[model samples]
Target: MNNKTTISSFFWQIIKPYKWWYLVMIPGPFVTAAFVFGYNYAIKLLLDVLTQDKILHYGDFVYPVGIFLGSHFMVDIFFRISNYAEWKSQPQVRKDIMCKVYDYVMGHSYNFFQNNLSGSIISKIKSINDGYYYLFESIKHNLTAKFLISLLCAICLLCINSKIFIMVGLFTVGLVIVSMTLYRKLGVMQGEISNDYHGVIGLIADNITNIANVSLFASKKAESQSIINHQENISTPLRNKWFKLNFITEIIVTMIYSLFGISVLLYSIYLKNSGQITIGDIAFTMSMTFLFQDNIFGLFIEVKKFVNTWSDFKTSFSIMQIPQEKIDKTDATELKVSGGEVIFENINFGYENNNKVFTNLNLKIKAGQKIGIVGSSGAGKSTLVALLLKHFKADNGNMIIDNQSIYDVTSDSLRSQISLIPQDIVLFHRSVGENIGYAKKEANQAEIENAAKMASIHDFIETLPEKYNTLVGERGVKLSGGQRQRIAIARAILKNAPILILDEATSALDSETEQQIQKSISDMLETNKATVIAIAHRLSTIKHLDRIVVMENGAIAEDGMFDELLAKENSKFKALWDRQVNGMVL
Candidate 1:
């Protein structure tokens, strides 16, 4: 992005209505400067009056001392109040920015989520929050303070001698130009280094999640070496950038200080020799010159920080600009799902590769019927369900529910009427009750218990020390494979959608548990009046299903009743059944 656009967008994104704190902070510099100027003037007066005529002048000393002390006290008070306001505004701004970012990410389509890592998204949001807070604090507190001090120094310098004032101002401006030129170069390096760091985080998260597989393959040492390599890659560039900026800033500041100090000393000597100014005037001028130099130094540091923050602000704003899926219009009609009839007419789609997974594939599922789908890996079973949920738009198709095109209805309304349990069951680190309640958030304890009973898991839950309150640990790792599958089933049961889909749902359970769970499910379907779609690998699991459809290479391989298919030799269904039966030693 160009500098102007990046800066404008960054400010618009991070600065919100609460930025009134910045306006409140504007006058702090003037107030502080006024007090400092008053104190300095009093010092000049005290020095001139006390030394002149060697007189007692008790009143003169007393009045000037009070003015100086009182002005110093007021400066301190203004500093404290301004600092308080600046810090107070930080947390609110952080919260507002984080909330907006959260909304943006959550609103994105599932495809966006598939392309990004959860840990990276979380890290980006956190990094942006900290960056914004620092940026605001630096501008509202430190920026204003330094700018005010610089102005005070400029006024003091002019009051002392206009020649020295203009010269110092010119030199300071030169130093700033040089520093900023160098800062811009380092800013690019910093941005690159930050991107590399994010890559490291993504890598570590991926590795840690797959640590079991890594250990199984004996690649632990190789993984550690890879991480070390990435760490060094990120650190080396950052160190080089920082060291270069540090070295350059130090040189410029030193040069400016040296030149200014020499000029002040020589000017004071020349004026004193020519009898143009008194020793007291020279002394006060020198003190004020040093004071102004200190302020100028502070200003330089603030400028460097401003440059770095500008870079980070640009990066964070760009991330927020990535396109997200558009939500349906506010007035879109709600889709009414009943009897679970699904009709697909002339459907066509592919994942960015343009190789269609389904092309003009028409199918109809009647209400109250159990449809069994069997397919090899990559046969588009999961893809079909994902499209049914409208996770992405079909290249061209009409997916109708209750005879209405799903696209015409609100997405949430369509999804709410269908319960899907995928092959991989992901359980949150929460209580069993809490996890199950995700399907029906308002469900009371009795409703939760009822759902568990329907899924054949209520007995197992009651055996735990805390029953429904038992913590499942991360991804429900504390539970056995069969137990976790049952909990997922309970969640789906609680949803109680008119249409239910179980994608390889029984793949993890033993035969006894599977049979019992299936029996419970059949009974519950009858009791609740729900339709079911089961995707299975064992083939035998669907012998009781109403209709079985076999898929091969993204197309239907065969479709027939279990008994009729068993009577035909070399048929896809019979071959699958024979393989499964022979594999079971019993």
Candidate 2:
């Protein structure tokens, strides 16, 4: 579909829910039109009365003036009230849109996040909010106001002598031509330039978020130069766009002003000679012409503003329409994870047309089995767990849990049975209590403390003056690497899912701390009878696991008990185990 159709459809979907606001706001323009007619007619009345005598009569104008002034005041009040109403309605609209976007983002599988940066997504939402608010407010206020005023002014001009009315009409027509020309030639170019400026802002956001990395690489100069290049690209076209429109608008304004001046001056002279009209008529017509021209100019300005904001609004709306990963029905049943039996039968998958990451991968773990997955960096160890969790759909075979196909279950139900602890830990910028409590928001203080103590972090937490109340900076930056990792582990432990997947969960801790945390993990899971699937680079971490599966070049090369693999010299697991043993300093 075309952009306008897409934007309109999305916009209507949002606006439908706020139908009350739409009902109240739709009449705003008619109120404005009434005000224009009342005020303009009042001016005409005053001029007509003045012509009857050399001086104006206050008594003759008293009632008409009151009606005129009263209408003006009431219209102003209604305009303000309507504008306020529309403004207030904006947040509801924004909140609804943002809530939908939030649901969409959160419901997406892990791979979706891997493909998109967190900071960039945030920047996109911020930009969308700004442009959209302006977009709707401009349509409600400026567009309506301009249309009503233009229509009333046209009627006022036409009621005057037809010849002069025709001249004013032609002048408005010429201005429209100029406006359309400017819009056609320069509007699209300006829009592209504006987009480039926004993209530069996105780049700056990304760089600031990674400032530590930039400094570590000592690439400040290169980064600055790159920013400068983006700035220049934005600035150059913006200057040209403004220059083109300014030159055109200036010409239109000048021509209209001169033409009206000449028309009034010549008309006054002819009226004086013919005695058909007086100085009062001349003054009134001149005043009306200037008023009419002002509204005409305003109409063009509002049209220009509409074009600019519409383009921005369309871009934001298009982004909002991007399809998120599917969510299932509320009634979709949850999976039974008590058995903790995960089976991947001949599963094969790839991403973005790359070479297959998993080919005919088959595995089945009995209930309560502790399996260790060992693989090189790109050997698809993580991809295997990801498939079991249904992060990305498999191209072949079935991933079954408790004899039920994973795809048959809802995402929430499937994921509710699994707990994942990745190597890098991420925590929100909140108190330790809140971050840990995130896994289960309704968790009580005792539950929180017990989980922390089980993860062996309660002592460290208690050392702080505020204990669990201490604030962790953005992404838990204030915490040390090991500390953040423990918080992540604490979260997974608290979740108490039946199937635990640890992708190097203890990689950050020292050897001594790693051993302690591993023992705690074993004790805690045994007490709860939870099964664990772990991927570890350090073979020592998984020495106690029930089975060790070694992966090489995206396929499982060996699988058996750790001691059995160690005894077999030709097994790939033995080779990796030997390398780790040889690398350690005795």
The per-model lDDT (C-alpha) reads: 0.77, 0.76
Model 2, span 1-586: residue lDDT tens: 2223465565677789877777777777778777766776677677677667566657988866986998888787877777777777777999876776566556665766787666556655665667777776776777777777767766765665676777777877777787778765556765676566556666787787778789999988999999888667766767677777768776876677677658766875686678865555565566667666676677677777777766655554554565655534455567877688888899888987677898888888887889999977889988887777777888888888888888778887888788888887888989999999888768999999999988889999999879999999887878887788778778887888888889888877788777777787776767666678999989888888899988887788888998999999798887787788899811
Among the numbered candidates, top lDDT falls to: 1
CA error at residue 258 for candidate 2, angstroms: 4.5
lDDT score for candidate 1 against the true structure = 0.77
- Candidate 2 clash pair list: none
Give the Å error, residue 292, model 2. Answer: 1.8
Q: How close is every model to the real structure, measured as TM-score? A: 0.91, 0.91
| Candidate 2 all-Cα RMSD | 2.9
